[model samples]
Target: MSELRTLYPVIEPYETGWLDVGDGHSIYYERVGTPGGTPAVFLHGGPGAGISENHRRQFDPARYDLTLFDQRGCGRSTPHAGLEANTTWHLVADIERLREKFGHEQWLVFGGSWGSTLALAYAETHPKRVSALILRGIYTVTRAEIDWYYRFGVSEMFPDKWERFLAPLKTPAERADPVRAYRALLTGTDETARLEAAKAWTIWEGETITLLPNPELTAPYHDGHYALAFARVENHYFYHDAWMEDGQLLRDAHKLAGIPGVIVHGRYDMPCPAKYAWALHKAWPDADFHLIEGAGHAYTEPGILDQLIRATDRFAG
Candidate 1:
C-alpha cells in the first residue's frame, strides 16, 4: 500500500457542457488537461453515480486530455432520477457520440466498478475505437456477482449490515427475492416508502464499499432526489442484469484481445469482489493485473487510488 504513487495535481476543466444525446436526454461532460494531449475518458461507478472532482485528479493534466461525464439521470445531467430511455446500450451509444464529437479516433478508457462494466461493453462492441483500457474494481455484472453482493455472499460477511439491508423487506418471499422487493419499493407510488428504501439501500452500499465504514460517504443518499436516482437507476439496471447475457463480458473477451488493458482490483472488495477481476484477467491475459493487498472496493482507498493513478500515468503515453 505504501508503494502507491501520488496522483497528479488537481486541475479544473477548461471546457464543460451538456451534450444533447437525443431522446430528451443530455449528458454533462467536461474536458480537462492539455488541448491536444493523449485523449482519455473517465467512466464513473454506479449506473447513477456521476463524476466528481476527485475523478479528474487521476490523470496528468499536462500529458493527458481527459473527458468525464455524468450518465443519463445522475449528476449534472438534466431531468433528475429519470428511468426512461436509459439502459446500458444507451450509455454505450453516448460514449461513441462523445468520442465522435471530441473528434478522437480512439481514447484511453478508464473506469471502475459499474464503470468497468460499461467500458468493457463499449470496447467489445466497438473494439476499434479503444486505444486501451484501465479498469479498477472490475465488475462484469455477472448474475453470480450480483447474487454475491445483493443476496447471499456479502451478507454472510457483513451479517449486521446485511440484516439492516433486509429490514425493509417483509415476508419470506420478499426476503427470498430482495432485489424484486426493493425494486417494487423503489418504483412504488408511495413517496415516503421509496425514499426510505433508497436510504437503506444506499447506506448498505456505502457501508460495505470499504473495509471500515464511512457514514459521510453515504450521507448524500439522505437527499430524497439523490437517493431516488442512485437506488432506482442502480436497481433498474441490476433488475435486468444490465441487459447483459450471463458472463457476457468474459464470453466476449476475445473481442478485446488486441486492445491493451490494465485491471486493478482491491483484494477485499465486497460489492463487486476481486474474483471478477481475476476472471477477467484469466480470459484476457494480455492485460496487466494488480490485486492490491490492503484495499476494498472504493476507488478512494489509498491502495486502490494509488494503483488507479499509476495505471492512468502508465497509459498517459
Candidate 2:
C-alpha cells in the first residue's frame, strides 16, 4: 500500500504557544501557508490527542491557508487530558475560538473518524460560519457505532483481538456494562487493569484502522496521553447518547444541505464503517461521497490519503 504523503515545502509551518481556556486548561495549535489564502482548519482524530505533523499534508499548503491544533489536553496542549475542561461542547467552543482568533468568518473544516463527527457537529452548530467540509472515516459515536467496533465491526478478521479486548469482562452483564469496565481501567489505581485496558484498547483501534502488514513507523495516537482523555470524554458523550437525538443530523441537515462537502470513505473500514458515510450522505444528499475500493479505515492507506489531500487542495484552490 502507498505510504503517507511527504510534507510539501510550499506548506510553511509555524507553531503557536497555547490558548488558556480556564480551569488550568490550554490548547496548542500551529498555522501554515499565507493567511490570505482560503482558510482551512484541520481537526485531527482522537479526543485525547492533538494534530499530527502528517495532518498538515491533508491540504496543499500553497493553495489553502492551514490551521491545525491539538484540542484541550491533546498533543502540544497544556494540562494533558485535564478532565475539568474536556468535552464535546468544550471542543466545539475551542474551534469557534480559533476561528475568531484567526479572524476567519468562514473557513473550510476537515476531519476524519472522530474528527469527522466533530467537524460535522461544529458545522451544524455554526453553518453560517463554515464554508464547506472535507470529511473522512465518519464515526457517529452512537451505541450502534460503538457496538459495531466492539462486537460486529471487525470480529471476524480479528476475533483473537476482540477476545482479548473483552477478556476483562467476565460476565455478560459486565460486557454489557462497557462503561464501567472502561472507567475502572482509566481511573482506577490498578496498574494491571489500566495497562491491560490500554493494550486492548490500542490493539483494537490500531488493528482495525489498517490491514497493511508492515514495519510500524508511526505511533498510534491512541497510545498517547490524549488517548486516555479521548476515551474518557468520548465515553462520557457516548454514554449520554452522544448528545444527539436519533435524527439530530437528519433533522438539521437543511442547515448544511446547501453547503459544499467532499466526503471520502473506505470500503473496508472497520473502525468506522462505510455505512455511516452512506447514511450521512443520504441525510445531506448534495455532499459528494467517494467510496475508495480495497481501502480500510487507516488514513495511511496508499491511494486514500493522497486522494483525500487532492480533494482538499481542489477545494482550497
Q: Please name the candidate that would achieve the greatest TM-score relative to the true structure.
A: 1
Candidate 1 C-alpha lDDT tens digits along 167-249? 99988999998889999999999998888898888878878888866666666756777777889899999999999999999
* Superposed model 2: Cα runs more than 4 Å off: 1-12, 170-172, 214-218, 221-227
Positional deviation of residue 103's Cα in model 2 after best superposition, in angstroms: 0.6
Report the poorest 10 consecutive residues by lDDT, candidate 2.
213-222
Q: Quantify all predictions' global Cα lDDT against the true fold.
A: 0.89, 0.74
What is the per-residue lDDT of model 2 for residues 213-259, given as tens digits with 9 covering 90 to 100? 43362355336454565555555555565567764654666778678
Please identify model 1 stretches exceeding 4 Å from their true place. Answer: 1-3
Each model's total of backbone clashes = 0, 3
**lDDT score for residue 127 of model 1:** 94
